[model samples]
Target: MRKLAALTTLALFGLSGAALAQEVTLRAVTSFAEKTTYSRGFERFIERVNETGKGIIRINYIGGPKAMPPFEVGNALKNGVVDIANVTGAFYTNVMPEADAWKLRQVPMAEVRKNGGFDYMAAIYAQKMNAIFLANFVGDNPFHLYLNKKITGPDMAGLKLRITPVYRDFFQAQGATVVQTAPGEVYTALERGVVDGYGWPITGIFDLGWHEKTKYRVDPGFYTAEVSALVNKTTWDKLTPQQKAILQKAGEEAEKEGVAEFAKLNAEDTEKQAKAGIEAIKFDAANTKLFLDKAYEAGWAGIIRQSPEHGPKLRGFFSKAN
Candidate 1:
C-alpha cells in the first residue's frame, strides 16, 4: 500500500513539470526608453500579443540600454540572451554590408509603409539575421539640418556638421565637414562648439534638447529613420500555426496604430518647435529640386560603389517600392 501511494505522487509530479515546461516566455529588449513613442508602440505590441496569445505565450519587455544598448540588442537576440529585440538596420552596416542599401534610396517613409517596402526589408532582415520579421515603425519625420548659427543653402559651405555614418556621405557631398559623434554625445558636442550643426530626425531635436542650442533648421527633409522589431528564428519556429497567426494579426494592428499616431504627433511637434523660437526654413522649389537631385545622386552612387555586391539587389527593391 505504501509503495503504491509513493508511485502515484511521483506520476503527478512528472505531469506538472511537463505542463510548466510548455509555457513560453519571450524576452524583448530595446534601446529606447519607455517614454519615447517608439518604445510606447512596442509596449502596445506586447499588450496585443499577450491578449491574443491567450497565456500560452508571455512577452517580457526590457527597454533601453539600462538593459542593453541599441547596437548590442542584435547580438543579444542572436545569442539568445534576449529572445527578441528592436534594432536599427543602419547601425549594423559593418556587420552586414548590404545594410547600406537602406540608406541608398531616398524613399519617403509613408510610401514605404504603404507599398510593402517594409515587408521587403523584413525579408532581407530575416535572411541575413536568422530572425523572424515582425513589424517596423517609422519615426515622426525626416532628418533635417540643425545649426548653432544662422545658415542658408550657400552659407552651409565649409560648415562642420555632426552626423551618423549613413548621413556622412550626404553631408560631405553638400560641402560640410562631417564629424561623427555618438548619438548620446550630440548635445554636449553642440554646446561645446565641437560641431557647428547636426543632421537628425526633426523630432529628435526637441527630444534631445538640441533645439535650445540651435538657431536654424532647414526644411529640406532628407531621410526617414526606420526601426524594426524582430524575434529569434528558433523560438518563432516553435510556435503553433495558430500562435503565429495570432501574433501576425497583432503586429498588423499595432502597425496601423503606430503609423497613425506618428503622423498626428509629428504635426503637433512641428508646431511646438516653431513656438520654441527656432527658425524653420522651407526651401524654395529651386532649392528643393537642387537638394533632391544632389542627394539622390550622391546617396545612390555611394551605396552602389561602396557595396557593389549588394547594390543591384537593393536598387531592385527600392525601384519596385519607389
Candidate 2:
C-alpha cells in the first residue's frame, strides 16, 4: 500500500511539472521567407528562446511573406493578428515615419541600448503602434544599387529603380523614377523591364537570384539596412515576467550573433557577386562624395518632412553627427 501511494504521488508531480513548463506559446512571423538572410536573425532568436525557454514558453513560427504580405506585417502586429514579427522599418514606415531614421543608425545596437536609444524607440512603438520594440536583429550592412544598366557616375538619369522606403527620396533625387515591388516580384519586375534595377544590401542578390539579372553594383553604398523583432503589446503584457525576461535575453544573444555573422557574409557576398558576373561600377573620389552627400541629404529631408517632430530628435541617436 505504501509503495502504491508513492508511485501515484510521483506521477502526479511529473504531470504538474510538464503542465507548468508549457505556460505560454506565442506565434511569430517574418517579413521574408524563413531560409533567407532577412529571416536568419529571427530564426536564431527563436532557436535561443526555444532552447532556453524549454518548459516556460514556446514560439510558434507561422512562416513568412507567403503566410502574409511583408507590408501588412506592421499592421498585423498593431492589430494583434500576430503576437510577434521580424521586419525592417522601411516596410512599415506607415506605422512610424520616424522609423526611416533607423536606416541612418551609425552605431551598433549594443551601444544604442547603453545610450538610451532603445528605450526611446520602445516608448515610441508602445504609443504609436501598440507594439513593443524588441531587439534590433541585424544592421550596419549598407545598401548598394544593383542595376542592369550602367552609370559611370552618380547620375541615375534614364534609370528606373525599385525603391524601398529606405531609398525612395534619395533615388528620386538622383534622377531615377522609383517603383515599389514586393521581394518575390522583383525578379519578374527586372525581367519585364518594370525596373532597371533595385536597391539591396551586398548580401541578398544571390539569395534571390537577382545576380542572374544584375550586371552592376554601384560602389560607395548608401544608408544602413536593418531588420528588427517586435512583439505585440497585448501579447507582451500577457507574458509572465519570467517569460518576458527569457525573450528579452534571447533576443540580445541572437542579435550579437546575427550582426557579427552578417558582417562576415557581406564581405563574402561582394566577392561572390563579382564571380557571378556582376561588375562593380565606380566614380572618382569627388563624384563618390557628391553621391553620398546627396543620398544622406535627401534621405533626411524626406524623413524630417514626414516626421517633423521626431526625425530631428532621432538624428542624435541614429547619425554619426550625434
How many residue pairs clash in all the candidates, one count each? 0, 1
Question: What would you estimate as the lDDT of candidate 2?
Answer: 0.86
Q: Each model's TM-score?
A: 0.83, 0.92
Please identify model 1 stretches exceeding 4 Å from their true place: 1-11, 14-21, 103-120, 319-322
| Model 1 lowest lDDT segment of ten | 14-23
lDDT of each: 0.69, 0.86
Residue range 1-322, candidate 2, lDDT tens digits: 9988866976777655346444688889999877898898898889888899987888999999999999999999998999999988888888877776788888788888878777887888898899988877775688999999889998888999998899899999999999987788888898888899999888887777888888999998988888889999999998988899999999877778777887888899989988998999988999999999998899999988998877777777777753
For model 2, the superposed segments whose C-alpha errors exceed 4 Å read 1-22
lDDT of candidate 1?
A: 0.69
Question: What are the per-residue Cα lDDT tens digits for candidate 1 across 1-322?
Answer: 9988766876877556335435578899875656564566777788888887765677888677577766666667766788877666655554455555555444555566556665666666667766776766554356677887665563467789997666776778888898876566788998899898887766656666777888777887775565667788878888777667777787777656666776777777678788888788777898888886676677677777766766666666565343
Candidate number achieving the greatest TM-score relative to the actual structure: 2
